[model samples]
Target: MSSIRSPFGQDVEKQGIKLPKKWNDTNSKIPTDRTMAVGGGVAVGGGGVAVSGDSSEFPRKRRQRYVEKDGKCNVHHGNVRETYRYLTDIFTTLVDLKWRFNLLVFTLVYTTTWIFFGLIWWLIAYIRGDLEHTDDGEWTPCVANLNGFVSAFLFSIETETTIGYGYRVITEKCPEGIVLLLVQAILGSIVNAFMVGCMFVKISQPKKRAETLMFSQNAVISMRDNKLCLMFRVGDLRSSHIVEASIRAKLIRSKQTKEGEFIPLNQTDINVGFDTGDDRLFLVSPLIICHEFNESSPFWDISQEQLAREQFEIVVILEGMVEATGMTCQARSSYLDSEVLWGERFTPVLSLEEGFYEVDYDTFHQTYPTPTPTCSAHELAELAKKGEEIPLPPLTPPPIQNPNQNLDGERGRGEWDEEGEVESVSNGDVKKMDVQH
Candidate 1:
C-alpha cells in the first residue's frame, strides 16, 4: 500500500487513491512530445514532427482536441478523471449532487431506515406477549390504541425522538426492549448529523460565489498612457456586493530545465491595481485590472508576434467576503493566448438610465478597435526616451566665375585691310590696320 503523511506525522495508507502529481520535481523525466509542443522551445526535434515551424496543417483533418474543458492546453496532456475507486469519493459525490436530487435521496433513505428499525421493535413486542387487553375485553397495544404491528412502530418513533407518551413505557420485564431503544436513539443522532452536515456543506460551497462574479469574454493587451498593459474586466452580477474585494493575477508558462526536466507549468504572480500598491478595489461596478509590462514583468520582452505564438495562460483570482452571507468566497478564470485581443478596448458596460444606474450585460463581452503602438512595450519606451529631434548639415556658398579671360580673338593692334577684307594671321588674327570710317 502507498502511504501519505498526515498532519499528525503518521503514515496513512493510500491504496486505490490517486493524487495529483507534483509538477516541479527536479529529477522527473519529461516526455519528448511535451517539450516541443509549442513556443518553438526545444532544441532537438520532438516526435519528428518539425518542432521549429508551423505545427498545424491547412487541410481538414480528423476531429481533435486542442484545449481542455478546464482551459488547459491539451496538446501534451489531459486531466485525470476518477480520483478514487469507491468509498473515498462518496463524500465528494454527495456534495456535488443537486439540491433537489439530494433532498429526494435523503427522504427515501431516511424513510427506509425508520421503517427498518420500527419492524425490529414490533417483532420484539409481539414475541414478548406485551400486547395488553382493553377494559372492554378487546386487545389494545400500550404503544397505540390499535392492536397491530403499527402500535409498536409508533412507539419506536416516539422512543427514538425521546418523546415519551406515558403508555408505551418499556418495563424491566423486557430488558432487550430498553437496549433496542438506546441503540435506535444513538443511530438517529448519527444519521441526522451525517445528512445535515453534508447538506450544509453542499449549500454553502464557494462555487456559488462564481455565479455573481463575471469575467469578460476576452482579455486585451493595449496601450495605457503610452505604455503597454494587459487588461480584463470583472463585475458583480448581483446588486448585493462583495466586501473587501481583492484581485490577483498569475502568468503561467511551461518551462524546461537544463537537466531536461520539464515543469508542466511555472507560475509568476502579477501585481493587480498597482497604481495604488493595494490590490483592493470596489467591485460594485465593473473593474478593469491592469498589469503593466514593465522591466521586471514576465512579458516585458515579449513582442506582438511572439506573444501571439506563445502558449501561456493568465489566471485571475478574485477573493472577497459576501456582504449578505458574511462568508469568504473566491472566483477564478483563465485566459489563453488566443483569447487575448490585441489593439482593442473594452466597451463601456455601465450606464445611467433616467436617475438610476444600470449595467448592460449584453455589452460585457464587446470590444472596439483601438489605436495602439505597433511596437512592443519595451521598444516603445526606448523610442520615447530618444525624443523627436532632426539633425541637418550646415549650408555652403557656390564658386564665382571670372570674366577677364575672354575666348574671343582680337587683332594684336590693327589688321591691314588690303581689299576691305581681314587677312589671316598666325594667331588666327591678321595684322589689323586701323579702319577709319
Candidate 2:
C-alpha cells in the first residue's frame, strides 16, 4: 500500500530536499512528554481541560500548590484573633475601620492641634508688644479689630487651615511674629499629611472586589430529580455582570500523615450541576450549586445522621472579573458540617412579575423541608432491593356465613331483629320459618 501524505503542510520534503543550516544546528527538541499514553493508548495528561474541583472528588486532581510568599505578604496578628506574637496586620486594620470612627479621630486631632498652635501665637503676640490701632496711632495691638490675645489665637487658626485669613495677618514689622508664622506653617503641613494619609487609607479599600457577592446562609441536602444532592446558593446583588465567573467547591477536613503531622486536607472537588462542565454558572440571578451523590461524590457514603456528626467544611469560592473595574475578584464562604441541613431545600427567591424579574432577598436564607431520603444513596438502594424481595401479606375475604343462622326458631322471622328472628338463604334457595299468630 502507498503511504498517505497530508496536504496541509509539507508532509513530504520534496525528494532530496536538505534542511537549512540554522534549522539543523538549533537544539530543536520538542516537548514529547506533556502527554503520556498509558495502557492501550489512553491519554492521561497532555493538556486536557482540568476538571473543576469540588469537595467530593479525588484530592490528587484538586490539590493546590504554593507558588511564593514574602514576609510582608503574611500577617501574624488580627484585632479579632491573635495570629502571632508582635506582628500586626496593617491592611486588615485599615480595612476594618468604621467611617464614624475615622471621622471622630480626625476631628479630635484637628481641634487639639488648632488650639495648641493658637495658644503659642497668642503668647508670641504678648511678648512682641505691637498693635495696629485706629488713626489714633497707638500700640493698639497688631490685630486691628480684636483684643491682643484673641487676635493671636485667631491668626493661628487661619494660618494652619487656610495659610492666612486677612482678618488676622502677620507681617515682618514684628520680627518675632514673622518667625512664629513660618514655624506654624511648617507644623500645619506636617499635620495635614498625617491626617490626610489616615483618611485616604481608610477610603481606598477594595470594597468593590467583595461587594454584591455572598454565599447561602446554610448548605442543604435535597433530592434534585430523584438524585440525592448537596446544595448551596451563591448570588451577586449588583446588576453589573461578573465576567467569566468560575466557581469551585472543596471539602476540607483534618488529615494526619504517617509522620504524625496533621494538616487540613482538601479531600476532593464537588463538581456542581450536571457534570464536570457544571462549574461555571450564568450568575445573572441567584444560582443554586448542586453536587450529586454518585460514586464520585464525597457524600455518597454519608447519610443525614452521619453528616450531622462529621467534622468537615465545604469551602466555596467564586472568582471572576468585575465588569465595571475589569479587576479579578474572589468571594468565598464555608459551610461546616453543623451548618449543612439534610432533607431541606432553598425556597424560591426569583420570580417574574409584570414582565420584570424580581428577587425576594427576604427568602434568600430560608429553606423548607423536602422529600429526601435520610439514608445514604448506597444504603437507600439496598433498602429498595430488600423491599422488592419482601412480598406483601395476602388479604383474606370475609366469610359468607349468616349471623341469623345461629339464632333460635322461637323468634319468628317476621319479627324485627330487636326481638329475635332468623332468615337463612341456601344455595339457590331461600327459607323463612316465621308466623304471626
Candidate 3:
C-alpha cells in the first residue's frame, strides 16, 4: 500500500496501510524546534505546519511574505525589458539619414539664398545711384535697370513653387536672370516628380491593394436557348466612391500533339455596367449574357474542368474623376474548380433589397428550353406529326460471296493484289513527301 502526505502535512494511507520505512529519515531534516507564538503564548506544534496561532500576527506576517514573493512584479519587469529592446532595434535599423539630402530642401535653400543676395544687390545699386546724384547734383550715375534684379528674385520664388506666375519677365539680355530661371525650373520639376512617384509607391504598397475589392465574388454558366451564358457579379465593399468599371474575360486552352503543345483559344470582353445609375456610390455590376457558347463558338470545345484548371482571370479596371484628378483602381478574381458550373446556366434574379443581386438557376433552366419564333407554328406542328409517324427504313441482306473467288468465280488469288509495292533500292530514288500536308 502507498501513502501520500496531505496538503495540510498530515500522513494518510490507503487499505493495507504500510508505513514507509524511510519516512522518518526523509523528514528528519525538517525544522521542528521553531514554533510560531500566538497571543499569550498560544503556539503551533513542533512541526512547521501552522496550527491555532494568534490570528492577527500570523495573518499579517503571511501576507507580507506573499507580497514579497509575488511573481507579477517579475513578469512586468520582463515585458518592459522586451519592449525597450524592440524599440531600440527598430530605431537603429530603420533610421534613414539620406532623407536629409532631399532635393526639395536644397532647392528651397538655393532659391532663398540667391533671392536674398539679389535684393541686397538691388538695394546697394539704388543707394549708390542716390549718393552719386546728390554729389553731382544730377540723377544719372549709370544705374542700368535694377528692375532686372527684382524680376530675377520674383522668378526664383515662382520656379521654386512651380507656380510660373508669369507676372515678371526675364530677358536673354540679362544673363543672370536667364541662368537663375533655368536652374530653378529644372530643379523644381525633378523634385516634384520624385515626391509624386514616392507617394504613388507608398499607396500601392499596402496589402489592401492586392485584395479583391468585392465580396461574394463568383461566376456561373447559364443556359440561353441552345447556347450557354456566362455571368458574374462584381461589387464594391468601400461604398463611398462611385466606381466606373470594365471587365474582360479570356478563355484559355492547351493542346498536346505529336508536333508540339500550344494554347489556342478565344477571349471575349463581356458587358460592363452598374445595375443602378452611375451617380450611385454603392454598386453591384451585373455582367450577364455577354457571350453565348454554341456549337460554332470557341467555348463549346472548352470543358468547364479545363477552364477551371487554367488561370482564368477577370480583371476589372475602374476609372473615375476624384478630387478633379483622374484616378484608376484594379481588382481581379480568379476561377477555382469549385466555382465552375458544369452543364448549368445562370439567370439574374432580382432581390427586394437594394444593392443585392442573385442568380436564379431554377427559373433559368425551366424557361431556357422554350421554343422561340425561329420556328413557325405551322412548321413545328408539321415536324412533330412527321416525327411521330416516321417508320424505320428496311434493311438489305448482304450478297453471298467467297473470299477466295475472283469476279470470274475462279479459285486461288495471285500472290500480289492491285500493284506490287514499289521498293526504293537507293536513298536517292526515295522521294520526300511534305509532312505538313
Candidate 4:
C-alpha cells in the first residue's frame, strides 16, 4: 500500500486499501508508470490503478471578466422611478418663469423697442405735416417721404411680427428724414428696456400653473335633493406658490328644430372653487336641476340610444394663470352613450398624479332619466270620444251556451248577461273585476 499527504498535510495511507496487487510490484518497471495517480492515493507501480477525490468535490477556479458600463442589465432595474424623478425635476423647474428670465428679457426688449419707434414716428408725422398723393388724388401726410415716420412705424411693425412687408420707403436726403432715422435708432436702444419691464410685471402677476388635483375620476352617488352634482380635481404644479382657481363647465348639445336645422343648447354655468392646498385642489359643482330632462325641454327628446351613437362634448374652462396675466386651460372630451348611463350626468376625469384627469360616465347617466310626455287636453278629448264609440268593449258574456248554437248567437246572449252584470256592480268594482278577470 502507498500513502500521500494532503494539502493540509494530513497523511492518507493506501497500503492494503484494496488497490490492485500487481500495481504494488517493485520491479515491474514500465514507461506507462509515469501516468500513475498521485496524492488521491490508489496507485500501481507499473500499469497503476488510478484514484481521485470525489468528483462532486472537485475544486474550481474562479475567473474574472469585463462588464460594459453602458446601462444594460441582466435584471429589472428601477427605471420608472428614475424616469419619474427626471420628470418631476423638469416640471418643478418649468413651473416658474424665473429660470427663463434671459429669454423673457430679450422678448420684452424686442417688443418695447418697436412700440416706442412707432409712437415716435407717429408723433413726427403729426408735427411735420408732410403730404403725399393718394390714389384718389387727395393730399395725405408724406410721413415716409419727408420725416420717414411712416417708414419707422412700418419698420417697427415689421420687426414686431418679423414679416417685413417692405412697402414704406425712407430716404436720408432731408433733415426731417435724418431726424426720423435718429429717433428710430434711439427707439431701438430703449426697446429692450421696455420689454424687460413688461416681462417683470408679467412674472410678478399672480398666476397659477396647472396641477394634478384628484386621484381618480369617480362617480358621485349622493347629491343635494333635486340638484345635479359634479366633481373635479386641480392642483398647482409649483410647490411654494398658491393658485387661486375657478372652474366652469358647459353642457352643449346640437339638435334640429322646426325653424331650422341642428342648433346648440347650452346649459347654465356650473362653477367650482379651490382654496390653498399642497399643489392640489378639489372642486364640486351642483348641476341646475331645473334644466334636467322634462317633456318641455330638449333633453326629453334625447334618448340613450341617441346619446350612445352621438357624442356630447363637455367643455371645462379653467380660469387662472401662473402670474395673474389671466391664463386659461381647457379640457374637452367626446362621451359615448355607453359612458353616460343611469340618468344623464357625468363626472370630470381626475389625475392619478398631478396634471392628469379622466371622466366618470357611469355616475352621470345613472341619475338622469329620459322624460315622459303627458297628453294635451285636445288629445284627451279625442281619446274620450273614441272610448265612447268603443262601447266598453261590449261586456264579455257568461260561458253558458247551447251546444248546437252558432258562435254569433251565443255571443249575442252572452253580451246581454255581461251588460246586466256590469249594471249591477259599482263602476269601481266593475273596473277592478274587469282587470282581475
Best by the TM-score measure: 1
In candidate 1, what are the lDDT values of residues 212-257, reduced to their tens digit? Answer: 7888766887777767888898989888899988998888766777
Candidate 1 worst ten-residue window by lDDT: 405-414
TM-score result, candidate 4: 0.29
TM-score of each: 0.64, 0.50, 0.32, 0.29
Candidate 3 clash pair list = 221-345, 222-345, 222-346, 223-345
Show where candidate 2 strays beyond 4 Å. 1-95, 98-100, 131-149, 174-190, 193-215, 222-229, 236-252, 262-282, 291-301, 315-334, 343-354, 360-437
Q: For residues 178-197, what per-residue lDDT tens digits would candidate 2 score against the true structure?
A: 67667878988987887787
For model 4, residues 1-437, the per-residue Cα lDDT tens digits are 34322222223332232223244556763332132223223232332344445533433211110110111111223325455665566433333457477476466656666667677666655565553333333444434433455566566676445465656545443466567666665665465455555556556544223332221121221122322233332333333332344444455444446886445433434333222222123233222112223233333344323432332333344444343444443222221112233222222222244665433322222221111112222333355568742112223433555433322341111122332332212112322123113
Candidate 1 lDDT (Cα, whole model)? 0.61
Q: Residue 421 error for model 4, in Å?
A: 53
C-alpha displacement of 363 in model 4, angstroms?
16
lDDT of 3 at 356: 66
lDDT of predicted model 3: 0.37
Tell me, by lDDT, which candidate is best. 1
Of models 2 and 4, which has the larger TM-score? 2
Q: Which order, best to worst by lDDT?
A: 1, 2, 3, 4
What would the TM-score be for candidate 2 when compared with the true structure? 0.50
Clash counts per candidate, in order, are 8, 10, 4, 38
